[model samples]
Target: MTSPDEDRRTGAVHAVAAYGLWGMLPLYFVTLAPAGSLEILGCRILFSVVVAAILIRWQHGWGRMRTALRDRRVMLTLAAAAALIFVNWLTYITAATSGHVVETSLGYFINPIVTVLLGVVVLRERLRPLQWAAIGVSALAIVVLVVAYGQVPVIALTLAFSFGLYGLLKRQVSGRVDGLSGLAIETILLIPAAGLLIAVVSSWGQLTLLDHGPVHFALLAFSGIATLVPLLFFAGAAKRLPLAHLGLFQYLAPILQLLTGVLILHEPMPATRWIGFAIVWLAVFMLVADVLIVGRRGRA
Candidate 1:
């Protein structure tokens, strides 16, 4: 058996690599510009299915995949999760490519908070005082963004809720479904729709893969790799780390994404948006601190 310390160290390494890759994804999406979001999404599904099939085969995960498919409940749950993830992917790609990188970053930053809220409502999980306070602060931040923008932050909210729900469903079928196998199943479920999309896009003469030359072709194919690698790392980490520790590392992706938006992409951060973001940061700090403090006390 692995020692706890060793497990945690390995988990941290995997988690960081996963989130770091995720954080850098905006740069990757930039390469797909001018490709319609739906088109790109179709390509993602198609190529991801291919990659996942290879992974499942290589890892000898077909047994698990077969088991999951045979189980009606698992299939139903993964189907829902697949739909949610598709929405999340579409929204994220649209946001990143449409100059909403900052909003995309903010969406991920808010996801953990949304997950916590989902746990409260869906799982009947209890929250400590600090957790409640964190949620309240996060709510305040959203209100501020709404008031300042004179509209709701739809991009951020959609990403958060969709992904949060996906996570919730995945939690229900956790050990029953292996990550690579589950991904393969989801992409396989989406492949028909993806094929339909490609045909439609091809008829419209707007398929980037058709006219954008070899570079575009390669990038589109690379989308599968981009999608799968981080997932593998995240799964490796989750298996080894405590939930609290894993939760702590989740912030890395968003923080890097936020910086990438502001510093690399040069997205505008107006004063009002900054204020709202500051409040959100405070909430995240509280949440992280709460987890750490409670974890320490439990250890004691």
Candidate 2:
């Protein structure tokens, strides 16, 4: 049996890998050339479905898939999540490919604030001072961006809101599907539609992977590993760690994403984005700090 201490470590690691993959996704998605954003989306969905299917078969999750399918409400909730994530992926890929990495970075940076906002609106939870300040600073960043860029940071907002709502929806589903099984169910539902989209793009000679060499196919397949590994790790950690602690691990991804945008991608923040990021991060730091401190005091 896994020890609680081990579980906590695993959870922390899971959160890091999950978010790290998400942050580095721009690298994976943008590296494929000659493919439109939507085309790449289709390929990802298709390939993911194929990979999800094989994993399901290996894990003998067919029975679970059948059960999830019969459950209309649960299926619908996941479907909603799928739609939101699909849009999120597309926008992220487009932004990364289009040299708007910083814009994409902003979306993820503020995602935590978005999650807090959901608790306020949907869960009717009262925000702590740190939470409120986080929101306020995040709001200031948005104001700065709109004032300077003249266009709303729609990509960032879409990513933040959709992912926030997706998490909310996932929280509502009481019966936990194993990570692999959940993905299989979600991918199975999405496969037919993804096929149609791929066909459309292929007809237009727009699908990028078709003419690419073996290396391209190899990279595409890596996406399956990239998609699956962290999710399973998170599921593993969830079994071991308390929600209070596992929850904190999530910030690692966006933080890494922000770092990547600044250091690796070399995307400029300008004065506006720089100020915006500072405020947003300050709020998150305070909120997370409060959580950690309170947690330790409770233990004491």
> Which one is best on TM-score?
1
Model 2, 29-136: lDDT tens per residue?
Answer: 767776777777777777777778887788788898788777888888888878877777778878877777777777777777888899999999998776787788
lDDT of 2 at 248: 75
Q: Quote the RMSD, in angstroms, for model 1.
A: 1.4
In model 1, what are the clashing residue pairs, if there are any? Answer: none
Q: Which candidate is the best by lDDT?
A: 1
Q: What TM-score should be assigned to candidate 1?
A: 0.96
* Ten-residue region with minimum lDDT total, candidate 1: 29-38
**Alpha-carbon lDDT of model 1:** 0.91
Task: State each model's CA lDDT, in order.
Answer: 0.91, 0.76
The C-alpha stretches of model 1 lying farther than 4 A from their native spots are: 1-4
lDDT of 1 at 234: 96
Q: After superposition, how far is residue 13 of candidate 1 from its true place, in Å?
A: 1.6
TM-score, per-candidate, Cα-based? 0.96, 0.91
